[model samples]
Target: MPLDTNRLEPVLPWLKFRGPDDRGIWSDRHIQLGHTRLAILDLSPLGHQPMSFQDGRYWITFNGEIYNYLELRAELVQAGYQFTSKSDTEVLLAAYAHWGTGCLEKLRGMFAFAIWDRKINQLFLARDRFGEKPLYYWIDQGTFYFASELKALLALLPHTPELDPIAVDLYFHYQYVPEPLTPLQGVRKLPAAHFMTLQLDSWKVDLSQYWSLAQIQPLEGNISELIRAELERAIDLSLRSDVPVGIALSGGLDSGTIVALAAPKYKKVLHAFSVGYPGSPPCDEREQARSLANQLGLPFHDVELHTEALVEFFPELMKALDDPIADIAAYGHFAVMRLAAEQGIKVMLSGVGGDELFWGYDWMIEAHHMTQQKQRQNSISAIATTLGKLAHIPIYEKFAVTPKLPKPVRSLLVQGLNAHLIDNEHPNQFVFYNLRQDFRSPWYHRRSLYSQEFLTQLPERNPFHPSVGNDAAWSDITTHLCQVLFNTWLVSNCLALGDRTSMASSLEVRLPLLDYKLAETVIGLQKQYPNEFRNKKAWLKQAVQDILPAEILNRPKRGFEPPYASWIQALLDRYKDSVVSGSLVQSSFLNRNYLVKLFQKPYNNYALVYRVLVLDTWLQNIR
Candidate 1:
């Protein structure tokens, strides 16, 4: 078997940002395999990939670092296996040689790889447990196409893919396209923690999960301490790299804890990178982020963003993300990764998974904790308003005349006292509800007018029933909330954002929190010790209290974001041309004239309007 250089030719342009260091292609009559190297570990000729085993029984073209490869390699050596290179690629090939698909369990790191078993004449493809890395594939006419990025797949495959209507509808509701469904037709994301074994003879596609977060084997005693130990072990494993590694530090507890733990394990001085916004209070985390980095004795890197800069980068950023995401914070993450790349760093650690796994989100945790007292108060308020009671006059006036109140008062009334009346209005509310309830017209204003076709078909499908962890029981609303947030928000949006942004600069971003072992432990602990988590991220705060100063460790969640609300007017004004000229609005499903009005509407509607802008820009760019 060999690689066809011609098939390799089309993906080179797409690979420029993914692997810029070295290029190689192997070709023969039956097969073509190509790899562009981003040399993190074993920066030598021997580490070159599409790497093959000694007996030529297995070959793999892999993306992502396997942190525990050294341990695996040592075990294989004891089993009398020989290696030619120090790269994890060789170790993975040996693991497959020794344990077969069992290798998936023993491996730890973010990855998406295809291993060709020469003896069996089959190709095995696998993605890491939580989807920290991405794999897209398209199969047509007996030939299979796969790539680390969707852009590469589109470039290499002959299919002129059309956008899937269902995916487009999901994109509007969820803000990012969900898994197993890419924005395009004929291409799909390989669901995480799963692998597919493919063969040419029968053309059978056998997809199976090797792991799940919900699978419970009761581990007794002090799960928090065990979780802490597992998290520390994951950090140790993630530090396995030949290149300089850094942290995407923020003032928040998650990244702060990561830096505190990782600094002690790393030998040389570690670096931390953070992004700040000029006028934005929440985005300006430099003051506190730098303070934590100083205490940890790590070198710190920082960049400041402004509205003008975000405006300029909008179109390019949308184009880079193969599908559009309504996450404004994604640009902030991209900026920090680009900062790392400019400094010649190849790998960085991030704190994305801590929220979903450990109950860091306040609204999500409070969804079940809402008091009977609070619900009664809300109902009383509603009835009073309906009957024109004098006591409810102030509330009725506030609700009826939503125009004149200052920003702060309106926010309090809508988010706090009026929450149950509104069902779910906050972004965090979307974490608990299914797609239909989550996308209700009152909150997501555009939900009422989605293309008639999608609206007709939407009720037949449930977006929350993800393929990976659907077996997890949802009878306990708390457990259901955690799974929903983890699957949809953590995996599809946050993790995907980190992967694309970091890889765009040829850097690897590792999230120790996403390690399958850690996730399973957290889920187990959530089941047994659900009471301890009543307070937001209390379990995690206790775990790291010894390592970090209380001042830094106890800080409430501060999002790393530019002032999206303040900058929304400018952002929309800048992209108005893109919206009017964009195909999504031009189509019968959506009115361009109506979309223009939404974008040009009054203040305080930034979140909804920017989502429209993101979708419009992405549709135009992908076309």
Candidate 2:
């Protein structure tokens, strides 16, 4: 696959951040394959990508490490496949040559790659199971384009891509565009666990799902032991890298668990990086991260975040993200990744997926509690509705036994009054509703800040329409809601931020908790013993109880976010005019008057302020 001088011109900017080593391009009239090497594995010319097999039947331009390459290479070796170099790229090519699409099921680790099957004149694209990596594609006027970043794919186009209105709608709803939808129209995400095949001549497309997290069921064994074994195995496999690997350590249970497990097998100093804010509240995890690092005999590295730094680097943060994500926490990840890269570390494992897998979010508990109260209220409401229809009584007349209840429960009941019959509503739907309304700050609360035209144009989209499965929990609704949050919130928003920010520094961030095997184990444990899924990450806590100190395990949930209040205030103090008078407001995507009011008033919700400012910064930098 020689570099086409024409295509190369537009793609050079993308190569600047990633391809520090030799760049390889394999191009012909029919197809073009390009790669920028980071040289993590088999750091030699042989590891150069756009790699092909001896017969040149399959060619791949891949990003990410195959931690199981050695094991896969061993199996391929016995099957009589010869390798020219000890590169995962070669193992990947050989495995594909032998097993075809079946090879994906046998591999582990984060990856997004395009394989050109010259034998069939087709292109096959696949992403890892948990979307630890992102692959975006656009189909335009008979041409198919895909890239690791939207900016990379945009480089190949002539004119600027328009902002997708629906995506902008979702960005305001969830602070990020939900997957299968990018900010640009015509572009779509290659969702995790899915694959696509394109016929070269006809340009016909076929997409398929190769794996499903819903395949989980109750396992017949001690739940804690099973989780411990599965997770330890994932860590073992993830730590198999040629270059030094580091840990994105924090005070939380997840990263602490990874460090405890990998400390023995890492075979190096086990460098850990943490982010802190200068003179801020006790939110920063520097001291806690340092304590854990000391207990584990690992070296600790950290960077202190300053408000001015976040304000000045605002646009670069959006550029690093390649898309707008309203999460202020991404800044923390960016700092740690930068620190790791500066120390010459290429690979790092993060503890990101545990919450999604083992039900670690605060909303999970809150949703369950709300659901219990709703069950009691609905029981009374259902009887009243029946009486109202039979006796011409008002629906609320008798139901007004009017017991005083908590505000959260009363608010949900009021919202559900005019709602359609939810008699058959799945537990997951209820969970999704409770979480979305309770956890998410929808724009209806800030409708005054939106233009009337924008309000009318806002599509009535339910972001939680995707299924996470509806069985095995006490009710189908419970687990279904959990899975929705896992996919929509964790994988798409959280993991997307992790990939973009880390890759912006040419650093690879791995998640052992997202290991399909480990995820399956947690889901199975919940299904098998539904009653025991009571505590947040309870199984996880028990699994590593012997390794993690009690203090670390008992610490309250401090999520992966720096002190954003002061940071947003600092940013607003410097750029309030720039945002209030910026394109986002002037274009009517936001209300100029409301923004000015927000700036002038003593706004308490600094997070909401940060989100809009981030949006404005992105709108400006994108051009």
Candidate 3:
């Protein structure tokens, strides 16, 4: 029997969610596509999507917001495009009809949408420049499947997808699987700034690049002035919500910048949400966030997280996540979204793309320093000698500098040092190691699992090529960061977590920072601009200077990391049987003894622990 649309009903249970009170899944046979709405703009019946447009000539299931819709609508109206709705979706349809694929260039936002063009008998699929929104698809026997979440696609597909063991290895090294590959082998993520048009008759999917971050160019202006103008524009574009809009304010620079830019424009005290834990050092950014909120005169809410909350929410988190991502930050996001829904905020803005766009990550600095240092070496032999010494130090201790070395000397010594930072364990191997450690008496033997020939042949069998090659050190920061951000963090964690958590509450979250125009412009910048991003978003800080407080401007970028290590240790002590004795250890997927060793060591491997706990909880629930 052909797979009925009715059978796809249980695939996306969260799409039927309305407000906070009623959140669950539903199925429909008549509708070919299902949507899990975030409700970012025009929070009316008119704005509801998987929406029919232009006298039902076209229907769209869109996952992201178009920030410049109002401006585009004004242009369309002038060009004789009348509207039945005040939705960006309608505006997008009109733009598509008028300009075809060219419409993508005229619009600015982070988005992924599937448009059914009735006249053309085709399906149009697209993802934004930096891939802030995810679009995953699986094509089999002339039937094409797609969804904002990979799990949704998996739910609809007839066959159980095979695990990509190589991807499992990549996940261990990168913490998230790089794009174009999912945990499942058959499913694939659409690349950033690209689109595909599927012809129904022939069942052909033609992919093309609508935009590229490589096209960004350094603009000639005062560095601070340029930063201010572009950032303000980006914020203004993101603030295009028709429903009540709010910010996920953090002590970090990016979210602070967003709050500062948006607060003055908001009529009432803007509702800001944050998350933390009681008495956790790394988790407490509440005081700084509170200070900024006070300065801006916004109503701020901080939810103190508890271990029980994490345990209770673990299964839901796993279900929302398509793959077993090791990034523990997803839990923090899940907590925040729960709080956001409780406050009745339909759409919340996040500063997710700031680090990728503005060279905000320490990796960028380290990569740059490493590249420069390698250049200064007299010979390849000399460079090899330095790497040999660094390799002698334990991988875990690599980040720490000798205490006797002066700060400047230490910086110089570490500058331009490039090596594979993760302990040489491959991703699948690491998973196996972690699992084995969890099961046995917390003791495991290490062994070289794969032969050199086996390792060499792995990539050949893989569907998606690794974004950064084995030999590629981070020589080019701009391109490298763009690839890493899009392929790894944005796809694997940020958008994935946001989609799951927000949809669980029937809320939509929008990211303006990942807008195509903004991303392209930032990526195009000269490598030497704004003094090498030494301050990490130094230019962005200058751009929003007038709007942001001086104190906030100078603050370091503390990313959205909760105190998972401390919480996990506490959880382990209290619920040792639940975690350690669970199926996670028994499964052949991870090395359980290594996990025990990780826990035994007095270090912060909170992310690793959380991964095990989440997997443990998930396995327990499913079993």
Best by TM-score: 2
| Cα lDDT tens digits for candidate 2, 1-623 | 33344685558568657657778778766778777887888987899878988678888999887888999999999999888998898998888888988989998878889999887899999988878778889887767778888888878776667767677767766778788888777878998888899998888999888876556667668888999999889999888777889999987899999999999988787899998877756898889889989988998999988888888787788888987888888888998999999998988889987777777778666666655454444344564344323321223321322556565544444444322222224333343432443123444344666767677777764443233233353354455656667667886788999988888888888899988888777777777777767567888999999999998888877756777667777778888889999978776777788788878747655656666787788878767
TM-score of each: 0.87, 0.89, 0.81
Q: What value of lDDT does candidate 2 attain over all alpha carbons?
A: 0.76
What does candidate 1's lDDT look like per residue over 243-329, in tens digits? Answer: 989999887888988899999999977899998877547558898889989988888999888878888998888877766778888
lDDT of 3 by residue, 343-429 (tens): 877778888878867778665555445434433443444543465345334441344356665766455444322222221222211
Say what the RMSD of model 2 is: 5.0
- The clash count of every prediction, one per candidate, is 6, 7, 31
Candidate 1, residue 32: the lDDT equals 67
User: lDDT (0-100) at residue 400 of candidate 3?
Assistant: 32
Off by over 4 Å in 2: 1-5, 368-428, 433-440, 445-447, 461-475
Question: Which candidate, 2 or 3, would have the higher lDDT against the true structure?
Answer: 2
Error of 3 at 155 (Å): 2.0
lDDT of 2 at 194: 86
